[model samples]
Target: MSNDVAILGVGMHKWGKWGKNFVEYGVKACLDALKDAGIEWTDVDFVSGADTVRNGYPGYVAGATFAQALGWTGARVASSYAACASGATGMNAARAQILAGMADVALVIGADTTPKGFLAPTSGDRPDDPDWLRFRLLGAANPTYFGLYARRRMELYGATEKDFAKVKVKNAAHGFKNSYARYNKKFTEEEVLNSPMVSDPLRLFEICATSDGAAAVVLTSMDFARKHTANPIKIAAISTVTPTYPNTVIEMPNFATDSSAVVGLPDAPFRDSIAKAAYEEAGLGPEDLDLAEVYDLSSALELDWYENIGLCKEGEAERLLNDGETTMGGRVPVNPSGGLACFGEAVPAQAISQVCELTWQLRGAAGERQVKGAKVGLTVNQGLFGHGSSVIVTK
Candidate 1:
């Protein structure tokens, strides 16, 4: 199948605790996207949903649930569950249908009504469930994993707390201009440094908050897009990859590191592997991107993505950040929409939200947060429990 899918429309719900149901937010985003696409629900040929565990029993069957809420039009449906990468996985599935000629117009939706406080494990104390065991045994909350990565970067790349704080400062400044962001307030290095510690090496402001939001996108075949609109943003690649065996890295909510007990870990890091695949599929390199939106669950993680996505060499992320290269007007701007650091983490909705930002930027609709003259853009995120993500979009 041809690797060509046009992004016709994008929509999103503001990131915050709006005290609303996930399905309501999903419907709102869907309607907004359909309106933007100049199409109605009945015009959709397929629907793909990114599922959230907190959204009740119907969450698992997200596509059908959303379809029913939107008044079903007999559209083909699919639901994907990949933890944080759920939304990107849904895009991958929808793109497959479009490329295969199974569907010409597809709607992708992701929404989440997150629980307040630290995200807890699933109910019941089943030792078989790794999510439960990690919380029960180690009490190693998500921040703990972030701390591990932060510390590793400090040790390996000489990244300082100040360097990490700068990331928060830059993102917060950008968020202040983003109306949809959760914490649209600026912060200084001292403020970030003084914030309460959630885990060693990670302060409260350093970690992204759990947010409630929804995002949707309308995707169609390039041929269909050309007939509908003279200018359409295209998704050149969608990479839904998995980690290589012997993944020594201890990821979020995981009890133990992938055992190095067998053969050693793979030659390339798991995060970089995702980008490599996307680059191969799109036939483009990181140097080709005008801007990027990466998963910045923590200020430190953003730096990690800089290296993983090939924006800089290992140990050079902090230098990029320090030089103001990753900010809005700088070279190869990243997370121009303020990223998770400012918008907070919306779980299932985040990956889709990233694309929404990219769509606006590519369309020159992004106001204050625009990466000037952005043409080729990329969105990179990682899902827990073997789900990986990377999406490359070009004008």
Candidate 2:
């Protein structure tokens, strides 16, 4: 009767602009996950894939595409697309199947081959599409929103550009030894501060870049997992909650916040609610987390996650970063895999990649970036629109 699903294996292709087809990257990661799980492609009864919008037709039907690429093993296939939360969506699908007795074993995969420069909206003059309207009218690219948040934090919480720089500095060092990280170079606060500003208060080093990468995981029912391994990292909860009405905070691809004129605010903010639901489902809390991997789209955003994920209270994230509580060997290391700061954004693959890092950490195999005695980890990321992605994993 447990809601937990066992994570038998996790894998990722090195993050970079390899320029090869996304399918190749996905296939490699899938194969690696299968090998790690000690299972065969034919052994999987379900395939759940996160869709990549940038890729063509095959990307749309990623589940079937990967199934075909892996030789059509008669596995049931499903694909999910929720912008940055795509991987979590696919993961939710796989977990549902396993928990519902539809399948004993499932494979979840995501990959992306990104385009250069700012991630713009898809072509055409569609006014109805808020994403397109944002680009066409206000030119409010992703960084623009990032900048707005940074500036707001600076104003309300006294967070300086230096505090933001320290986030990049810390994450850079964490990722320095990470082989899967795209930017494995250590960075100094000076270097971060000196870097050109992409968004006000956000330097080039602070903002994550677009990259090509893939990540995958093998999941099974607890009964199936017990047959294979004595101990397995269990996915305790997966939260893909949608934003409540009157989502006051402005989200990405949208120009304005929801008007609170008629409806009252929800009891909790959207971002805070994301992890809250997962925590409730897992019977855990922020205090129970040994470590966390949060979406760091911008260096300043990492601090925001500290509060949103309950690492600290609002306006206290800068204090946590400055106090070293969120660093390696600290109370609760955040982004031990270097986060998006080191890996950049691979869209559909990002959330799954976060789970992969947690899987390694829980197994005590994360090498230099490992958090000592790490038993439980959480990942929180938000995709465009109101997609909320957060997963709780425990050893």
| Candidate 2 off by > 4 Å | none
Best by TM-score: 2
Worst 10 residues of 1 by lDDT: 253-262
Residue pairs of candidate 2 with colliding backbone atoms: none
Q: lDDT tens digits, residues 1-395, model 1?
A: 26879999888888899878899989999999999888888989999999999878888888888999999889999999999999999999999999888999999999889878988878875899888888888888888899999999999989999999999999988878887888889999999999998877889999999999999999999998888789899998889999888777788767776777668779777899998889999999999999999999899999999999999999999999999999978999899889998888888889999999999999999997888899999999999887889999988
Clashing pairs in 1: none
Query: How many residue pairs clash (N, CA or C atoms closer than 3 angstroms) in each of the candidate models, in the order given?
Result: 0, 0
Per-candidate Cα lDDT values, in order, are: 0.90, 0.94
Compute the lDDT for candidate 1.
0.90
Q: What is the lDDT of residue 243 in candidate 2?
A: 87
Using Cα atoms with residue i matched to residue i, what is each candidate's TM-score against the true structure?
0.98, 0.99
